[model samples]
Target: MEKDAFAQQLPVEKYTRNIENKSIFYVIRKEGDLTKPNFIVSYAWGNYRNDLVMTMFGRLMLLMVGLIVISWLPCLGIARYFTRPLVQMERHVGRMAERDWHEPISTSRKDEIGRLAKAIESMRQRLVRQDRAQQFFLQHTSHELKTPVMVIRSYAQSIQDGVYPKGTLNESVGVIMKEGERLRYRRPEIKWEMDLAPHTTLIGDQEQWKIALENMLDNQLRYAKSCIRIVVKSQSLDNENAVKGQTSLSKFCISNDGPLLDQAIADSLFEPFRSGGDGQFGLGLAIVKQIMDHHGMTVRAANQRDGVSFYIEPGKQTDKTSVPKVS
Candidate 1:
């Protein structure tokens, strides 16, 4: 048929043909010589196509199974690699929550997990330091309170036994009263004059600033003879760059008509548990200093002409001469 005609005309060796809408493959090979007869083989294309599809499908299945089997251990190892640090971190955080900050988080990997571990370790160190400091503060506070309490108790006991510890009933009672006063909380008299500028605003923690201001006022009231003055005003600052114009800054000054502070006392005024002119060691001024430092503000005491003055302002300027007077 068409194959025979093609073979006779062109000496076909191999070819595919469509007959009656069915594909077939033919192969012809020379046998002995030009005159000798040749061999011809033919097969239905459907059989070859089916065999090819089956072979390819089997190989593809085998390859996929091999790949999965080869990668199984590696996949598991990678999963553990990522999850192990997370599990350790979870346990560490749990311990930290329970206030156990003894162990340190350690990691050598230069990745996100490493950074997280370092940060947690830093936080743990800070918490440890804070806890130690709190303990120290409590110990000192208890000691300070215990002295007055013991004094009061002893004086009261002596009076109850009909004995004057201070040589007289009134004197002994006065000693008790003095010790009791140390433990008593009294409201301020609020007799100081305030010259606050209208709409004056300062950027700081309100409650902390209140504590600091109250501590300062309490200190002044304890020493002031009669008059105390508070002044709040906004001062204009000339910017080094003219294009930036000027910035307004708030200044606070409190003055009391009290005895001048000794240079030694003024130098260590903000130190914790330091005794003031009244021979009373307290944390009030120390708390004020801490609050001011935390808010990035500056506070300084200066011996004014007639009394003592405290200046609270922003920035690192500690020179009293830099502050403007609002008299």
Candidate 2:
């Protein structure tokens, strides 16, 4: 790969962006390979002389000089309005390379730069959505398996207490044992909720949705103290969802009594490979972000007067109902 990349960087005899308005293949052969003969030749597949690059060298150089002039101190100040955003974007990528996404690329432009800014903002939001979804998935997955596990724990103790005879209990009791084993290795727990409004069934990978929801519930159950609340409400104009132009949504929140994490720490919660808080791979939230990105949703964290809360906000639906569950 490095060799291929370096080969592309080799000084061009002549380089010109003003090629034929069509794409053509550029073929190169190994040095001194005499499959046919030893000759220096080049060709093009589009109209216009293939030698245009060679002749246009002067114009290209002038363009370069013109750019240099345009970037001079006085001109630079004026150009900063356009170039600043791109420079920020480049810096943003560098931060992203270091596994940072909390800082967004900033821009104040109404042209092409604005479009790029919008794109980056959209990407940031999508990423946030994915992270939240992932956290929920892993948490629920761990939670779902707990019930059968507890059953086994209970019955095993019962058998030791001689609560039921061995002959009469072997069949159904054996089933419980099998289920315990199945759940023992599973991560997270399973939780369910139902509401009458009937959040219109969304067309999606049903399996993925179930896993994600379960993971969220698991996270809540694990972190929550006594009570956790979840509310699936219509995407309403009264909420921030309206600002983002969201129509229908499934908002899942898990409020806990635990001390709210500072923004600096909480911001890092969804990052992959980041284990910021106790009992956390940090991949769960990352996965949630990915799933939410695919589904066009948003997630946010806030500290309420009573406790800390995290919300999953979904968008995209004209009219729909919601099914919410609370624990």
Candidate 3:
């Protein structure tokens, strides 16, 4: 067993000639005299303490064993460190695949592997920024179209309800046409906003910002009974990466206070089509979130004891506008 333990640490050809059928075994025995009641002093495998010389067949076998060990043994050991980062990288890749980017390569080592890890992490962050941008693009478009629709829908309903005088039918139609034109023209302004800033800047779209602010305020106005607190602000965290670094941000945020959203609902409050009140369409907050993202800001909703608060940050809103992309 002792010999076996040693051989196990080695490869197949280390102790045997053939990889197919191997020869290696260990035994245990008792110590003292040989004649001591069937007791064995010790045990060994192919025990010999002399130089092994042999014929061509035997020499060929030994040569093969030497080559295998010399070539591959050291490789296995070195490969462990090289493979370690790759394994960790694989884990990170899987996590990212699951749409998780909360963690990045904080590795500070200066090596090829370390550099590769940082590069991958940087790429991931860029994708995250893109996500925010896409949401803003969509949100801007939807909100612009919704405004006129609201006005027209209201007027149309009012007319049907006898609230409109007989001579005002033409006025209602004119207002509807005006609202329709705004939707048709300004609706695509989101795409125009996106083209104004380079992606590396992590820029924000003004269209998206307005949509988010309106959503928060609208929600508060609809459900808060009376008071609705709305706030918009921007700031940047200093980058530790600078030789003597600066801040970087290109966006803003909108927050509001109302009845506390349920914990479960708040967690997913930014998701589209999610509602928490008596009954709602649930798209309001989702759209707000979508717009905030395009502008490279994060959206957070939390239940304040008396009401609720949401926060926003601009992609380029930070005072340190020169922060590096990777640490």
Candidate 4:
């Protein structure tokens, strides 16, 4: 059997021989007869590629490298797509921290990030408005304070120099007192005749209107002898001029029985820095005018029999006149 295995010319295979310096290869028989002897064959084919790597192994390594390179682009694109919103949010937050409100944000998206952006944008707008309001307040306040401070200092120096005004010092002292009053909030003794509607609600910043009203009352208080009257009424529009459905216009009027305003002073009463023979600057009325304008209202000063009446028409219709909540 061993001689026949060696002598056979065709390819043949059998159980491996227990010997060194021999190799093995598998091959199929050429005759296609399964029943014949030595139908399978084995031989030692010298290594082709190298001792370090086989041909099959090298092919597999090349295929793996190609796959990794091909997949790199798609992986990078997917990563950027997922992080795009996060990057936008970071930029928006940075702008907010810097107090930049000029750039508007996108609110059209219907997602969680969209909602977050919308909330932040809303906060930015409110902060911008408040900042602008504070700046205006400071500018007006400083301007108003400057004249009084200068006047007080000048008068004090004159008194020290033995130079006095011809009339009593009461008027000079009253100048200082009035300027001081402007800075301090005081509720003085006077009769308040309020004929306000029950609801009396208008679309406005209540605090701002309150400050404006206080300024008006304070100005009147400085001159008023006994009474100050406030009237809030809904004036019905003439049927012919009325809009299709709307009926009445809300109006607020304040009158004081101190003294009738002078015609010249009344003309420039709402202008800043103009005075009415008193030590007070005209900033109070100017501020009132600004507040009315902010609320889209119109204010007019008219001479009354005893004093002056400030008529304010806040342009809107009220739902109903209920007692205003005091809180």
TM-score of each: 0.55, 0.37, 0.34, 0.41
lDDT of 3 by residue, 105-194 (tens): 667768998999999889888767656555665676677778888888988888888776335888777887787776432322111111
Which segments of model 3 are wrong by more than 4 Å? 1-165, 168-203, 234-257, 314-327
lDDT per residue as tens, model 2, 1-327 = 224323443322322333457644443333443343222324354444556775698789999999888779777787986787788888876776675777766666789878987897788776765666566657766687677777777777777787753455786488576876674323233343333233333324556566666656655655655556666655433433333543334565666665666777578765665543554454556676666565656666677876677777775542222422211
Residue 145, model 1: lDDT of 90
Sorted on TM-score, highest at the top, how do the candidates line up?
Answer: 1, 4, 2, 3
CA shift at 32, candidate 1, in angstroms? 16
Q: Which stretches of candidate 2 lie over 4 Å from their true place?
A: 1-199, 235-250, 315-327
- Candidate 4 stretches greater than 4 Å from native: 1-20, 25-53, 79-95, 107-123, 143-154, 157-162, 165-171, 189-327
How much is 94 displaced in model 4, in angstroms?
A: 4.3
lDDT score, candidate 2: 0.59
**Per-residue lDDT over 86-153 for candidate 4, one digit per residue giving the tens place of the 0 to 100 score:** 68778877987887766777756677867887888788786776566556666777887888788777
Better of 3 and 4 by lDDT: 4
**What would the per-residue lDDT of candidate 1 be over residues 236-269, giving only the tens digit for each residue?**
4443432243334468899998899999989988
Top-TM-score candidate index: 1
Clashing pairs for predicted structure model 4, backbone only: 12-41, 13-41, 198-322, 199-321, 199-322
Cα deviation of 208, candidate 1, in Å: 9.9
lDDT of 3 at 163: 74
